[model samples]
Target: MSTELLTYLFVGVTFTLYIGIAIWSRAGSTSEYYVAGKGIHPIANGMATGADWMSAASFISMAGIISFVGRDGAVYLMGWTGGYVLLAMCLAPYLRKFGKFTVPDFVGERYYSQIARVVAVICVIFISFTYVAGQMRGVGIVFSRYLEVDIVSGVLIGMGIVFFYAVLGGMKGITYTQVAQYCVMIFAFMVPAIYISMLITGNPIPQLGFGSEVTGTGMSVLEKLDGLSAELGFAQYTDGSKSTIDVFFITMALMVGTAGLPHVIVRFFTTPTVRDARKSAGFALLFIAILYTTAPAVASFARINLLNTVSEASYKELPKWFSNWENSGLIAWVDKNEDGKIQYTAGKSFAGKPSFTDERGESGERLINNAPTEGVNELYVDRDIMVLANPEIAGLPGWVIALIAAGGLAAALSTAAGLLLVISTSVSHDLLKQNLAPNISDKQELLAARIAAGAAIVIAGLFGIYPPGFVAQVVAFAFGLAAASFFPAILMGIFYKRMNREGAVSGMIAGLAFTFAYIVYFKFVNPADNNPEHWWFGVSPEGIGTLGMIINFSVSFVICHLTAPPPQHIQDLVEEIRVPSSNNAAAPVEGGQTANA
Candidate 1:
């Protein structure tokens, strides 16, 4: 069968499976909608968390960024994976023990303030929206390529599917759906890596293949990549360009951000016990590591294949994938100097290079300038297209390419479901049922959750149609916001008995304000001001969250010491969460109890 037909078959099958799972696991109550009735097995919840954590950024974008950036990309691998350890140890179990349906529920009860809960709801909404936008965009990219639809149409299709499943099943449907999604995404990601590895280095495992010598060239993969990078005027693959401090802080930011992410933390709440929550985190990390470890190998393989395939090739002689991507507007080439030979290098501009003229050809196609320039650079490749294009670039089988299409959609949709849940739960449970409409029935709340989820999907779809930035960059900003606003407050609430509502609320607001201001100023107001030299304390925008986190911790502690300590009963509630006793574990509730321990 043709690639298009194969893609349709595979993607169609996956969609059918997702819809079936959603229907099978349809939720009946608010508890079922919010926490899957708190009956998820540790292993199952772990797999679900893995799927939730590994969004499009991990599945579609990480390898692509790593392929071009090389060692610098290690931060993403380490930062994202390492944060799970913190979640498992410092946050997940305690939050799960608190037995609340939402992150803001814990914050509100823990701090004993409606203001604190509202603040948390705002933070969760902001972070979740920022993250979901990228997932929506990922869905669009996959659909645009595989289904041959425009991005807006692709986003709408995705929104429709997610709305059907997520609104119907809520957390229950999303969890089971994610379990299947994890399997599909992992298989799709691994197969191409293994195939490319065997083709390049005669090794089946991508990690091993990345270190092995090329089959014919007899040079190690890294050595060959370094040589090619030098030849092409790009940085060596083994070396990184970021400063040490920037790398340190960015990694720290991602680590804390991962732990603080409301969606990930909410997954632990689905587990039955605190011990299960901890165990689930371990299993989730293990599953995530499968793809995380394979990604670098895939990056190495893609870099090698791309350079070998494109370098010094004439425009007319280039492979079919070249023209395919070019037609998609992701890859561009101009025959500068009219030599007809393609030059693929860094820092090349399309301006003053080539332009389409008004004149028409015999076929009625617009005629463009074909004159070649003396410069040896004529191509521009968007990094985001690397992974999706990798299978084609390597001449993989049609079925394999189709599987990747399903995998990308799964990755994007699964995480989008998870984030939308956080958004909806925050609005319905935390904002409405808990604070505003305390007497609301469970049935009413369930309807509100569904409505909120549908609204969130529409907003997420709009963001996808007009993305604020690249997938990874927007996600990094979300992480920054999470790290600054949520991590410190949650951690302090669990670890420090003296922490009071006044301090916790103040810290969250300060952190959220500071991080949001910095990101907006650099990313939107003055993009030129994002350089290292201009950054406060030399911290890049990606790493600024670490500083914001510190500010939160410092400000909260200072204010806590200055003000009266938390009431004795609140301290007892803190002690109760710290201990893992099953007897003390509170029953999961919409409006959780005040600190009456």
Candidate 2:
């Protein structure tokens, strides 16, 4: 069958599987809708969390970023995984023990105020919506490229899938579906990476293969990569050219932001016990590492493959994938020097320089059709295409390509569903049911939840269509918001007895406002592109989340010292959340009655 037909078949089968799963598991009560009835296995929950956590950025853009950034890119690998460590060690157990339906319950009760709960709800909505928009965009991009559909159509299709299961199954449906998604995404990511590694270096482990000697080349992989990069004026693959302080702060920001995210924290609530929460966290990291470790290898291999292919080729002779991507505008090439050879020079110059010399030519700077590009030039291949394009770049079979398409969509859609669930539950359970209309029936509340979820999906899709520049940048802001606003309040509520309502509410506002203002000022108002020399203390807007988080902790602590102590009842609530008893885990809030009769 043709590639086009095969793509349709693959997408069709994947959609059927998702629909089948949704039908098999329909959430009945609020408990099932919220936390999978608190009966999920540790391994299963871990898989689900992995699928939920690994967004399009992780599946599609991660390796490509690593490929271009080299050692400097290790920040993502370390920052992302390290956050899980913090989660497993410091946060997950207590939150799981709290046993609440939503994170706002903990904030409200622990801080002894409904106002704190509202703040928590706002934070959750902000973080989840911003992150979900990226996932929707990712889904659309993958669909447009592989399925030959427009991004708008792709987004609508994704919206339909997310709407069905997220509304029907809630967390219960998402948990199981994500488990299956994890398997598909991971296997699809690793297979092509391993094959390409073997083809290039005679090694199976892509991580080690990145540093090992290249086949038929006496030089080590890093050495070869470094040499190739140098020839093109790019940074060495193994060198650290970035300012150490900036990288440190950026990595730290990402780690703390990961730990602070409400959706990620709520995953722990689905487990049966504190022990399960801990174990699930470890398992989630292990599953995540399977891809994280291999991602670097894929990036390195693809970088080399891309350069070799496009370096000397003419436009007409380019492969189908190249032409297809170019037409989509995700990839662009400009022959600046007009030497008829595409150049891969690394300097600040936007002009094209010859990337690879044509072995067939003697004196002319003319690029050869033998390679991927026609003339000496610079090509802009989007970082997001690395994972999806890997199989095609390596000359894999059509099935593998099809599998990749499904896998990319799976990764994007799974995360989108999870985030949307969080947004809906926050509105329905926390805001509407708890505060607005406490007497609403469960059926009516669920209907409200469905409406909330559907609305969030449309807004998220629109944002994706007009995405802000830099996928990771927006993601970092999402994380920063979580860390600054949610992490401090939640952590203090659990670990500090002195944390009072006033302190918690004030602290959340401080954190949220500070983080938002800093990002807006640097990202939009003054803007980095327009004012390159005006960064605050040399910190990029991406790293401001860390600063915002510190400000939150400081304000929370200072306010707690000056304010009255928490009421005796709130102290007991803290103790309850910390304890490992079944009763404590039964209801997330002490007075909030169960929605189910």
Candidate 3:
């Protein structure tokens, strides 16, 4: 079959499966809608979390980021995977034991303040939507490029698939589907990576392949990459150009932000026991590592292969994928010397590198520009296209191409469902039913949850169509917001009994406002626009999220110390949430015996 037909077949089949799962497992009650009736198995929750965590960015964009950024890209691999360790160890079990449907519930009940819940809701919406927009955009790109659909229509289709299950099955239905998505996405990501690795380095393990010797060449892949990079004036492959302090802070911020994300935290609530939650987190990371470990290898291999193909070649003779990507505006090529050959060379470093001169001896730009180049030089490759372009880059079969398309959609949709579920429950269960109508019936709450989830999907879909920026950068924003506003509040509430509602609320506002302002100023206001001088404190907008988070923690703690202690009842509530007794382990509701010992 033609690649187009195969793409349609695979995508159609996957959609059918998701729809079928939704129909068969339709939610019947508020419990089912919100927490999958709080009956999800630990392993199942782990799988779902894996799917939810590995958005289109993870599956498609991560390797691309690594491809272009070189050494600094390790921060993502370290920060993202390392954060899971923190979640598994410090956050997941305790939160699951708290047994709330949403992250804000813990914040509100633990702080003994409804105001804290409101602040949490705001943070959740901001972080989740920011994250969701990237997923949607990823889906759109996959569809537009592979299946030949319009970008907007692709986003709508992805949104519709998520809406079906997210509204029909709620958390319960979405959970099982996400498990399936995890399987499909993982398989799709690893197969091409493994093949490419073996082809390039004669190594089977993608992670090790990164450092392994290139086939028929005695040099290690990293060494070769470093040599190639230096030839073009770029830094060595494994050594970073950014300061160590900046990289340290960026990694720390990502770790804290990952731990604080509402949708991820809420996954633990479905596990049956505290131990289960911990085990589930471990399982989730294990599954996630399958791709995370392989991603760097994919990036390295693709970079080498592209350079090998394009270097010293005429522009019109470029590979089909090159033109395809160039047409998409993700990859650009310029013939600086009019040599009919694309020359990629490292330009002079601004600090002290040699300045260039034209034929007339007038000073010229530091670099010759093009996608494929001759010596050490500057070359621009869009990181977002790395994964999607991998199958073709490696000359994989057409079926693999179609499978990747479906897999990318699966990754995006699974995360979208998870985020929409949290958005729905936060609104319907926590805000409307809890605050708006205490007497609301379970049936009415279920309907409300569905409506809220559907509405959230629509809003998220729109943002995907008109994405504010790159997938990884947008996702980093979500992480920063989560780290700043939610992480500190939750930690203080659980670990420090002296923490008051006023302190938590103040901290959240400070974190959220500061992070948002910083992003706007650096990313949009004054704008970096590819200029290095625009960064503040050597922190790009992506790294600034960490600064926002630190500011949040500092402000929250300072405010808490200045405030009076919580009232007796609130103190009792805090104590109750800490205890893991089975009787109190049931979902939180008014008039229930406090879980406090």
Candidate 4:
């Protein structure tokens, strides 16, 4: 079959499988909807968590960013992976032992204040929505290319499909679906990596292939890339351009942010025991490393392929993949010198990303409204397209290319569902039933959760259509928000029995406000001044969360000293969680409720 037909078949089949799983395993009660009835096995939960943790940002955008930014992109890999370890070690099992339905549940009861719960709910919504937006954008990118639809239409299709599964099945449906998604996503990712590795270096393993010598060239992949990049006025593939402090801060932000992310944290709550949470976390890391380890190799292969085919080449004679992406408005050529040859050198082809016009140029390339800049570079390629376009760029099999489309959708939709569930849980369970209504029945709350999820899907779809930045960059901001707001509060709540409601609430508000304002100022208000020269302490917006996290920890500590300690019962509960004894695990909270209840 043709690549086009194969793509449709793969996508259609996967969508059907997902919807079928969701319908068959749909939730029937609040317990099922919120925490999968706390019955998921460790290995399965780990696989599901892997799928949930690796969003569109991981599967689609990470490799793309690495391909473009080269060595500097190591921050994302380190931060996200290290953050998962922080979560698994410091947070997951304890939160599971705390026996709360959501992050807000833990916050409210631990602080002994409804107001704190409300604050946590606000943080959850902000963090989840910001993160979900990237997943939606990833969905739109995959659909726009393989499905031949505009981004708006692709987002609409994704929104509809996600709504059916997420709103209907809730956590129960999502958990099992994610297991399948993990399998599909990993297989899809590795297949192409293996193919390209064998084709380029006579090695089947992508990780090794990354460092192996190219088949004909005596130089290794990085050496060849360095030479080509030097010729094109770009930095070496192995050398980083970002300052050391900035890399440190960004890495710290991502690590702590992963620990604090509401959606990923909640996955542990679905497991049956504290030990199960730990086991699942381990399993997830193993599964996630499959793709994470291969990403550098995939990136190297793609960068080499891209440069070998297009740099300073004639536009008309260039491969079909170039025009295919050009027509999709992700890849544009200006023919600036009027020499009929494409220039793919360092620096921007224009002032910003291309603003494509409805009309095409004399050579049938997408016309951009942005005026061409004064440079040898005449190409503008969206970094997000690197992974999706990689298979075609390397002339991989039709089925392999089609499989990537499936994998991209699986990765994106899986995380979107998880994030949406967090939003729903926060609104229906935390905001309404926990604080406001307190008297609503389980059925009413379930209905509210579904309604909240449906509304969140629409809002998230809008963000996908009009994303603030590239997928990885937008996700980094979400991580920054999470790092600033939730990580400190949760850490102190667990470790410090003296932590008071006043301190926790104040710290969260201060940290979130500071980080959010910083990101908004640089990324939105004064994008022109977003360079390192104008950054505070040489920290970019992506890394500002580390500073915000310090502020949170400090503020909470000072406020705790100034205020009375948490009540005796709350202190006992904290001691009980830290003891880690299953026999005495059920610590009592206010209203005679057991922590494990």
- Candidates in order have lDDT scores of 0.87, 0.79, 0.79, 0.91
Query: Number of the top candidate by TM-score?
Result: 4
Q: How far is candidate 3 from the true structure (C-alpha RMSD, Å)?
A: 5.8
Tell me the tens digit of each residue's lDDT in model 3 across 1-597. Answer: 987799899889988988888888788988777777767787888899999988887887778878877888888778888887888788777777766778988888777777888888888889899999999999888887787676898899888888888899888888889888898898888888888888899888889888899998799988888888777666777877777767877787788888998888888877766767777898898899888888888889988887677677776666666665544445555445667676665552211112433332312223334122343333345568788888887788889888888888899899888888899899988888778887999999999989999899999989999998878878878888887888888877767778888888998899899888878776777664534465667776666778877787788778888989877766655565566554434534334643221
In model 3, which regions exceed 4 Å deviation?
346-380, 528-536, 576-591, 594-597
In terms of lDDT, the poorest run of 10 residues in model 1 is 358-367
Each model's Cα RMSD: 3.2, 5.1, 5.8, 1.9
Identify the superior model by lDDT, candidate 1 or candidate 2: 1
Ranking by lDDT: 4, 1, 3, 2
The candidate with the higher TM-score, 2 or 4, is 4
Write down the TM-score for model 4.
0.97
lDDT of 4 by residue, 1-597 (tens): 989899999999999999999999999999999999999999999999999999999999999999999999999999999999999998898898888899999999999999999999999998999999999999999998898898899999999999999999999999999999999999999999999999999999999998899999999999998998988889999999999999999999999999999999999999877878888999998998899999999999999999998897887788777777866678777777789788788876553444433324323243335456666778777889888999999999899999999999999999999999999999999999988898999999999999999999999999999999999999999999999999999999899899999999999999999999999999999999999999999999999999999999989989989999988989988887787755535665666777662
Runs in model 2 with CA error above 4 Å? 347-377, 528-532, 580-597
- Models 1 onward score TM values of 0.94, 0.92, 0.90, 0.97
lDDT (tens digit, per residue) of candidate 1 on 139-173: 88888777878788999999999999999999999
Evaluated at residue 130, the lDDT of candidate 3 is 92
